[model samples]
Target: MLSGLQRDSFEYSIHNANPVNGLVRDKSRDGWPASIAAVGLALAAYPIGVERGLMTRDDAVKRTLTTLRFFATAPHGPEPDATGYKGFYYHFLDMHPGRRAWRCELSSVDTALLLAGMLAAAAWLRYDTADENEIRKLADALYRRTDWQWMQHGEATVSHGWTPEKGFLLYRWCGYDEALILYLLGLGSPTYPLPAESYRAWASTYRWKKIYGIEFLYAGPLFIHQLSHLWVDFRGIHDEFMRQHDLDYFENSRRATFVQQQYAIRNPREFEHYDELCWGITASDRPGPRTLLVDGIQRAFHDYIARGVPFVRRLQTKKEPTWRGGRGLTSR
Candidate 1:
C-alpha cells in the first residue's frame, strides 16, 4: 500500500507529461522514478507473497531479476505510447538527465529511491542483474549529492511527493527502518544526523495544526511504504505526539485528501472512490481555497509537457496581471 506513494508520484509525473497537457517539457524524462518504483514494488511485494507461501521464492526471484534487467537497458522509444511506457522497463527510459542541475531535485531523489529499490531487491531476493553495479553507483551518487538547498520547510503542503524536509521526517518517525536507511546509507544522505532535530522542528514549528494534518498524503507514505520503511521508529515517536494532539493517522490523511480536492488533484485509492471522483474543490464539506497553488503547478507542468521544451524567456513587453476570486473582509 505504501508502495502506492511512489506510484502516485510517478502517475502525477506521467499525467503531467501526457499530451492532454504537456507541462513538464523536456523534463518528461523524469517519469523514470515511477517506473522504477513500480518494478521495485512488484519485486518487493511479491516476496512477501512468497514468504506467505502464496508463490514460490523461485518465482519471485525469477520475476525480480527479469524486472531489474529490463529496467537497466530499455529504450526511450516513442512518446505517448502507453504500452512501452506502461510496461515494466520502458517506464524509466527518460529518468536521468546527463548532469545534475538544480541543487535539490527529483534526479537525486529518484536515483536514491531507485537504487534503494535495487538494493532491497538484491538483499531480499538476492538477485543480481547487470545493472546491480550501476544501481550501486547511482546509490553512491545519491548519498554524495546532498545539497541542503533542496531541503525546504513546510513544502508538503503542495500536491507533489516528499521534499527533503519531509524526507527527513520519514527517516525519523516512520516504522520503515530499511527504507530510511536506503534514503540515508544508499544516498549517503547526511539526513540522519539531523533527523532528530529536523523532526522536532517539524512537530513544533507550526502554530497551525491543520497544516500539519495537510502533509500526511505525501509524508506518510514516503517512508511507510515497502520501498522506504526505515522511518518507523521515528514515526512511532512522532505518532505519540500527534496522538496526544489528536492528529492521528486518519485525521492527517483526511486533511491531506481535502487539500488534494481543493487543488483538483486525484486521491490515492484508499481515500474512497466516491469521494475522489465526485469530490471537487467546490464541494461543501471540502469548500475553501483548498490549495490554489496546486492549480498554478498544474498549469506550469501542463505547459512543459505540451511544449517541446521550456525556455525562460524575457518578455518583450511587461504585462500586468489582475486578481480574481471572492474578496476577503479587511480587518480594522
Candidate 2:
C-alpha cells in the first residue's frame, strides 16, 4: 500500500494536470503560478513510493530531481521559461506577475519545506553524487533564522507581514513542521544540541485563536507530525513544552480542509469558490477537474476539515480576541 503522502501526491498530480501549458497548474484562482505546495508534495511522494515497494528510492529520487529541474526552469506566469513567480514572495497569475513588488524575503518556513522534500528525494534517489552537505547547508540556513512567532497554531502572517494572527491550518502541513523541528533541535546549526529553554521560549510565546481554518487542517499536520517526532526523542521536555503552551490537537481543523477537498471533487468549477474554500485549497486542482476521494476515510476527513473552516475564519477575521487565544492558557 502506498503511504498517504504518496497517494495524495498522485492525486494532486492528477488534479494539477493541465493541457493549455505542459505544466502542472498552481492551485489558485487565475492560478497560473506554480508554488512550493506542488514541489513539496512531489518531494514527499518519493519516499512514500519506496515504502510501498512501488519504486526504488534511487528511481524515485531521480524522477523527483528531474521534476525539480523542470520547476526551476519552467516559465512561471507570463514569463516564458523564466525564473517565474516565487508565490508568497513573488507570484504571477495567468502569465502576469502580481502588481505588488517582491518584498517578502525568503521565508524560512517555505525554504525549509522545499529542502525537506528535496532531502527526502535525495535520500530515496541514492544519488551517489548527491551533495548531501549542500542540502544540509541550505537546511541549516533556513532553520537558524526561522520566526517561531509566525507559527502559532491558530494564526499566521497578515498580508502586510506584521502582527502574526491566526492562519489557515492547512499551510502548516506544507513545511512548518520540519522547520520547527529543526529549530527546536538546533540541528540547523553545526552544533547538534542547544539549551532546551530556547524551544520552550517558542512554545510559550506562540499565540492564536481557535477556529478551524483550511491551513490549520490540511497543512497543520506537518507541524504536528514533526513535533510528535521531537516528543518521541525528548518526551520529558516536550511534555513540559506542551503544558506551557496549553496546546492540543484541534482535530476539527484537519476535517475542515478535507471537506473542502471533497467539495472540490464534487464541484470542480467556481460554484462556491470563496465560501467553500480558501486561497490555498482552491488553487490546487488541475485540468478537467472532478472530485473523488481516493482514500476510504476521505469522507470522514472531509467532514472534519470542512467543519473547522468557519470556526477558524471567524477567529482570524474577528477583531476581538476569541476563547482560543493565548499560550499556556485559553482565552475563555
Candidate 3:
C-alpha cells in the first residue's frame, strides 16, 4: 500500500512537469505555479523511477538533462519576471514562460532543496557518457553560482528570503526547521561558503526538551525532521551540537517521531481524528479555509499552511539571550 502511494505521488510530479522548462507544478489543481521544491523532489525521483522500472533509463536521463539545461541557461536578473536572481530561483515560477510567478520571494531553503535534488541526480547518474558528464557539470555550476554570503544579511544565520521591493525578510532561520540543509549546503559550498560560525549560531538556537518523556531537538513540524534526512544521512554523524548531546541527528529524529506519536496519544488539544495511526501534522493541503462545527465542536482548519505543534515551551525569564530575539526555555 505504501509503495503504491509513493509511486502514485512520484508519477504525478513526473507527468505534470512542464516539458519546455522541466519545472514541476506546486499542486495538481488549476492555476498552480511551479514549485522549485517540487522540481527538486522530481529530480530526485527520476533515479528511483528508473530503479523501479517505472521509467526507462533513457527517458530519465532526457528529463534530467532538460531540467539542468533550463536552469543553466534561464534568464537570471533582478527583474520581477526573470527566472531567478543571484542563483536563487523564485519560490513559485510561471509554468509557460518559466518566469518568477506571483512576485514571490527568492527562497533560500527552496533553492537548497532544489540543489539537493540536483546533487542527488549527479551522484546517482555517474557515468562516462557525455550527457551524464554534463549533468554533473551543470549541477556543480548551479550550486557554485549561488551567493550564500549575500543572503546572510550581516547575521550569523541566513535570512529566509529576499524580495525586490522589500529587500530581505526580517525572519531568519533561527530555531529548528527544515533549514538545516540550507546551512549545511551554504557551509560546504566551495565558491561561496559561509563562515563556520553561522552553523554554530544556528545550533545555539536549538531548544532541547523532554516531551512525554521523549527528549530531542524541538521542532514542531514532522517535515523539519524528514526533509533534511531525505538528502543527507545523519546516522553516526556528530556535529558540535550532536556531540554535546551525545546523540546524532538520526536519533534525534527518531525521538521526535516517537514524541509526535505520544503527543497524539495524549491528545492534549482533544482534536478529532488524531491518534497513533493518523497523527502527521506538517505543511499540507486541506479541504477548506472555513470553520465548521462537527458534533457540537468548533474546529478551525486551513487551506495550505505550515501547521505545527508546540513542542518547545517559551517562558518569560531573564536569562542569557539566544539569537533571533528568542527567549531561553527548555520545556513547556
The number of the candidate with the highest lDDT is 3
**Displacement of the residue 130 alpha carbon in candidate 2, Å:** 7.1
How does model 2 fare in lDDT? 0.38
- In the range 1-332, model 2's lDDT, one tens digit per residue, is 44676566565644563322223345534545545434545566656767877657555545554545544434433232233333221222232322212322223344444445655555444434564333334334433433343333333321212111222233332222334543543433433233445455444434333322322312232234342242224333433534544433334233434544543544433333544343324211133233455433222123223322222212322332232321111223
Task: Determine which window of 10 residues in candidate 2 has minimal summed lDDT.
Answer: 157-166
Instruction: Please give the range of 10 consecutive residues that has the lowest summed lDDT in model 1.
Output: 322-331
How are the candidates ranked when ordered by TM-score, highest leading? Answer: 3, 2, 1
lDDT of 3 at 27: 88
Task: Show model 3 residue runs off by greater than 4 Å.
Answer: 287-289, 303-306, 310-332
Q: For residues 283-321, write the lDDT of model 3, one tens digit per residue.
A: 757765767887887766666553565322333234311
Arrange candidates by lDDT, descending: 3, 2, 1
lDDT of 1 by residue, 22-122 (tens): 11223234432234444444444554656655557665555554444444433322233221211112223233331112222233234344545555656
Write down the lDDT that model 1 would get: 0.35
Residue 81 in candidate 3 has what lDDT?
81
Better of 1 and 2 by TM-score: 2
* Local distance difference test scores for all models: 0.35, 0.38, 0.84
In Å, residue 118's CA in model 1 sits off its true spot by 4.2
